[model samples]
Structures are given as structure tokens and as C-alpha cells.
Target: MSSSPATRRMSASQRIIVDITDWNRFLFAGKPISGVHRITLGLLRAWKKLGLPFEIIRHDPETNRHKIISHRFIEEDFSEPIHIGGGRIEYSYNKYVQRRTRYFTELAKAKLRRFVKKKEVVHEDFIEGNYEPQADDLLYFCGAGWDAPETMHAAHKWKAQHPGFRFVVLVHDFIPLINKVYRNRLGTRQFRRWFRDAARSADEFICISDNTQADFMLHWRRCGGQGVPRCRVVTNPHEFLSVSDTRNQPMSNGELSAETFLANRNRRYLLTVGTLSSHKNLERLLSAWNTLNFFRDPEADLVIVGDNDPRDVRSLSPIRRNVFLFQKPPDDILKLLYMNAFCSIFPSLYEGWGLPVGESLWFGKVCLCSKSSSIPEVGQDMCPYFDPYSTEEILLALTNALFEKDYIPSYEKRIDRGRMKSWATYGSEIHTALLKMT
Candidate 1:
């Protein structure tokens, strides 16, 4: 069978005009800081390394339009000294009021965190501008569009203006729609709006997983929508332990950094990386850990490495002992944790792509993950699985693997067979496919 255009690669001589129009978070933070932010930076950096010609653009709040940004803008905001607090920013009269409002929201969040540290907080500091979509340019949303309605609405408007203009969106997941409990009422409603708008606006979608694409299609049908776009299942690329990644790479001495050593205290640990949110099903994992009789491995600790605190797990009866919660540790420390871990555990109930699973596979480590959502799609036959819902099943899987003398070697062999495409390859492939679309 012939490959679809979405999957087909462009010739070497072919070039696509890709306009990345969704830098909503960066525009707010003035830097790529969080995981969501890092995904955009990593992929863009990879594309630049591949010498793919692309432009960065943002929606104009004033006029609600699209426009190409100046290269100087990139240098100023991304590369050089910024306008505010050593950060680059676009200043506008309207945006000034908006940013000031958000500044106070941050203070409010700080106050609220004292009592409810787990609350998901967002305070944006962004600028406004106007732009028009060029003919033959392929628009790419760099992140979730719901956070910036201007960007989402602008895409729809531009599509209406230029009916032949092609655009692609990255579907991280339909987590909110799939599990309503994952998000609050406001977040759920906003994401639903983005989904409906994005489904209508884009010519194609790059799904992070087959499960994600399926979920999107199912939601599309449920919304009484017709004619699904060309959705390609391209999982996120994994960058393995870089011997040269000094920024976040473990030390060559194979010893944890002094600070990390002091923090964790050289204990046998099972690492779980990602936001410590309710969606990750941390509560069940904690419950299982509590029931497992820590006396069997007194030195063993479950280290939750993430930004958001797992508030749901705090309420578990007879909470798991020796639970170490590390909030937003440095990348080098995270690498050290992963490298020294007895085993990595990811008990997320839902995921668009289980990145921690991919990370474990990348590192040739044994990962015991929930056999739910897109996790199995990533793990396949390699990583061990347990039903995240039943605490007993999780405990059963963990006990079998932990007590087994030869399980690590057996699973490491399985990881060797499970290969993933690198970011460099993903960047090159996406460039080719998108050029073809253009």
C-alpha cells in the first residue's frame, strides 16, 4: 500500500515554510521552563539542528490575526537579553494591564500554596501583535492552543481567509475529555473548546500516540463532527543519557552530586518522574506501597520526582513509609536518580504518551507501569505492567519483580529490543512530512 501524504517524506530539495504560532507559555514566562515548555524548545532546537527553515509567530491580541515575526525578535527574546527581569518580553499598553493582573495572580497563588500546595497555578505575562498567514506556509502549533484563545481563534480565522493554507497541530492527549476527574471545571471547559476549535482549524494532526489519535477521533465523533483530518501517530522522541549533557547529565564519576546525595541520602529507591498530579494515579501507587510491608526492604523508598505535589496520595490511609518527594529537582539530579534507581515506577492512569516509560526504555531500565491508556502502547512487551486501579494488582506486580533475583537482567534485555526514534530523527522526519503537506 502506498504511504499517505501525511506519512510520506519530502525530497531533499523540497522546503516547507513552517510557522510555529503557539508559543503561548514562553510568551508568558519569557523562557521555556516547564515540561510543556521544554517540549517546544527541544523539538524546535532539533529542527534548527536539522537546518529546517521555520519562523516563530504569535497571535495578535489586538487585531486577532496572524503574522510572521521578525528574526530579530527571535534573537532578542530567545537568544539575548530580554526586556524585563533579565527576560525578553514584548511590551504593549493593553498587555501591560493584562500582565499586571497576572502578576497579582502569582502573589495570590503563592499565598494559596501555603495551604494548598498542589493547586495547579497559571500566571501569564505576554505581549500583543498582529500578523497574516502567508500563502503556502504550513502553520504549526508549538503547544496547547487552549491556553491562548487568540492563537486558536487566529488559526481558524486565517484558515477561513486562506482556504488552501495548510496547518498541523500536535495532539498531546485528550486526557481531559477521556477522564473528567483529571481537570477542574474551568480547565476541562477550556480544553474542550481548544479541541473543537483545533479539530476544525488544522489540516492534519501529529498524535503523540495511537491511543491519543484514537481518543481524538472518538471525541470528534462524539462532538457530531465529520471527516477527521489526517492524524499521524508519531511518539515523542527520547534523548538517552548524554555523556556530554553537563547541564542535566549525571557526573562522569558515576557518583551523585553532593547536593543530590545530601537530599536523597543514598537510599535504594524506585523513581517516578512527571507531574505528581491526580491524573498520574499516584494515590493507588502509594496505597500499594503502604500495603507492601516496607519491612521487607526497609531501605527502599519511593521517590516521586516531579513539580506538582501528589496531594491525592497524602490522604492515603497508613501512608507509604519512606516516601521522598522531590519537587522540581535539577536535570542532573533527575538523571542521577534514574541511573541509581532500583527500578522506575510509573502508575499514571492516563497518558497521551508515557514519557517516563520512554525514558526508562531509553536508559535500558526496568519500568513497572500501569497497563492503562497509552502506556502499554509505549512499553509494548518490555516493561512490566499492573492494573493501576487495583492496589493489590500493583503490589502483586511490584512484589514479583522486586523479589525476583533475575528480573532486571531479563527486563534490560527486553529494553534492548525496544527501540525508539531519536529527537534528531523525529525532527528530520517531521520536516520532510510537513514540507510535503505544504
Candidate 2:
């Protein structure tokens, strides 16, 4: 018996190129803000640490083409042109004028899809004709969503034409459709279709979590799809280091310690950090917090540090009295908050990997997360769990966590656990996974 061609090809040094269509300046044109952006930055840092010979190809809106900005030493390169819709503008804004402008821009861009497709064809032809004279050169497609259809198509075409190359798709999450919270977005359907196509076409699939891999398998089965690539769950890495020097660090930028923020000199407070979105189940958390009488106790303040989604801004009005929501804060301040807080509460209804769960644990702070999606896989037993749907259960859990005087874990135990789960270890795991793929 012998292994298949795919298995044989995996054992070699290869030049890898990752396509990031929705990253960095592209996602945040005006300001550097967004969870995805921050996460992407962390991943890039980790990739650099791995010392892999790879390049990042990003879509440039001005040129309507993918350009390699990071690694430029390669001789043969193909720039894929991507067709983007104006729907983002409409989805992001609500005013009539803004909507009209967005609609028109989208319509115009939609009409230019054929042109973009042609440019991609030309680029592929140039690569095939000029560069890939040898057969061993491999190209890997890495990304989650359907935002880069052109690059995906190019990868597929190149793989078919140059049978030696390998293509891999990165699966982030399958909740955009299955989860009712985000069903309204038309782009979700487009992304799903693209994901299916890319998954089927790729030589392998890289899943961010085991939960995501299971969800993707279920999705593929539901759609009567077959021949999907083998998937390997590789958790995203958090490369941020703990600040060694927190002495005299100013927490005065509206970012206060858990003790001061709670307005109680003696009692502990619960904390949650993430965007204020419907899927986050903040309303339920707030309802539970209110029931626990956190505000009156003067010892418990539910400090939320993240920007609020404009659509859900009004939903937060009723809970505004007790909940302290900071739009944005520096990473140092956030790290300090995580360290000082009694516990970090993450009641998200769904998540791809639940970065905060690991992050909180990394800081030696206990986490209270819902036993839903990928949270349990990340939190384990170190952090308490709660049923996200049941407000009463959440309330009970919070009360026990805060009011019970003897419920605290030993400080030495926490430090021991935190030492075992640092970002360096995470980065090493990811590096090993990439090496296996090569």
C-alpha cells in the first residue's frame, strides 16, 4: 500500500502565499479599528515569528488587483483582480443619501465584474506563460470568506492547469447562515457559496477550531456536497505579550481598575469585553446583571470594553445605567483590565474560536463563558460555564461567582495554569501545523 499524491507532496519546502482580501487598510480605510483587523494583525505577527518563506497578497481597491506587498523576492508572481460589491456601504450606513450613493456604487461595481474577471484571466495567463516553467512551485490559497472570489478562482484554475500546485482554504466559521442573528446579510449567502467552492477545490482545508471543522462538515453534508478536502484545526494565535512594566501606568483614560470602576473599595466586580452586538447576548447578560442587583451593591460593575454596533446602539439604552461601555481603549489598558478584573464574562451565543476565553485564562483571570459554539473547547474547566439562553441560570452563576467569599481559586494555581497557556506555545503549535502542510 502507498500513500496518495497529496500526502507525498506535503513533504517538501514550498513557497506559500496567503490572500487577505479583507485585511488591514482594506477593512479599515479611515481608522485602525475592528476585531478582525486586530486578529489579522496578531496572526501576521505569528506568521512572521514562524520564519516561513511566504508572502501576503492583498486586494487594492484603487487598482482593483491583488498586489504582493510583504514578500517581494519571489521571481514568478500572479496578481489576481477581485470584484467587490458596494453593498458594504449600504449595510454600514442608513441615511437616504448615503444609501443611494452606496446603491449606485454597488451597481456600477457589479457591472464591472466581467472586466475584473477578464483582468484575472490575463494575469493567470501571464503567470502560466512566463513564470511557472518548473513543476514543483506550489501556491496556497488561505482565507475564510468569499470576499476574494477572483483569487480563489485563479487558484483553482492554476491547480487544474499546473497539477503540481496545492490549494488550501481556511475555514473561519459557518454561523453566518445557521445563526439567525446574521441571516439578514445577502453577502453571507455569497460567502457561503464561495466557501463551498473553495472547500471543494482546495487540496486541504485549515479550520480555526474543532468546532468550526465540525460545523463545516455538517454544512457540507447538509448541502449534499462530497470530496471536500481533509481539514486540520489550527487555532488562531495571540502574540501580544504581558507588559512587564505596569508600574505607574495611567488608568486615567476613562479605563479604571475593577475596584475603582466598581466604586467599591472591597468587593469584586464581573467584567466582559467584546463588541456590543445582538449575537453577543449582552441584553441577556444585562438583564441577569440587573437581577443580581450589581449597581446597588456598589461592589459590582459590569465593565464592557468595546465599540457598540450602530444597529444595536438603541438596544443598549435601557441597560445604560449600570453597564459602563467604553467605545475603544488601548491594548495596555485592556490588558490591565483583564489582569485586575475578578473574572471575565463572555456570554457570546456563538464564536469561531473564543479568543477572549483563552486570553482571560492567559492573564490568570477566571472566565465565565456560555457552553455554546467553540467556547467550551477554549474555556475548559478552568472557567465556569453558563447556559446562554437562560437568564436565571446566568444570574445564579454570577451571584455565586461574586458573592461567595470562599469560591475564589488559589492564586498559585491560576499562575500555574496561565504559564502553560501562553501565546508562545500557541504560535509554536500553529508553526508546526504549517510545517505539516508543507
- Poorest stretch of ten by lDDT in candidate 2: 73-82
lDDT of 1 at 388: 84
Model 2's lDDT to the true fold?
Answer: 0.58
- For each candidate, what is the lDDT? 0.62, 0.58
How many clashing residue pairs appear in each of the predictions shown?
7, 0
| Clash pairs for candidate 1 | 60-129, 66-131, 66-132, 67-131, 67-132, 82-87, 82-88
Best-matching candidate per TM-score: 1
Per-residue alpha-carbon lDDT of model 1 for 1-438, expressed as tens digits?
A: 111223555444333443444453445445434454456656666666666676666643222334445444332223212331123433222221244587467545545544564542221222223444655556777576666555656667767787666768888887777554385665666677677777777788888788888888788866545685687876776554221122443222124332455465655667887664668877777778877764466357777776544453455635445665665455556676777778898988888888788777777678998998889987887888888888899888778767777876688777753267577776766666576566
User: Which candidate leads in lDDT?
Assistant: 1
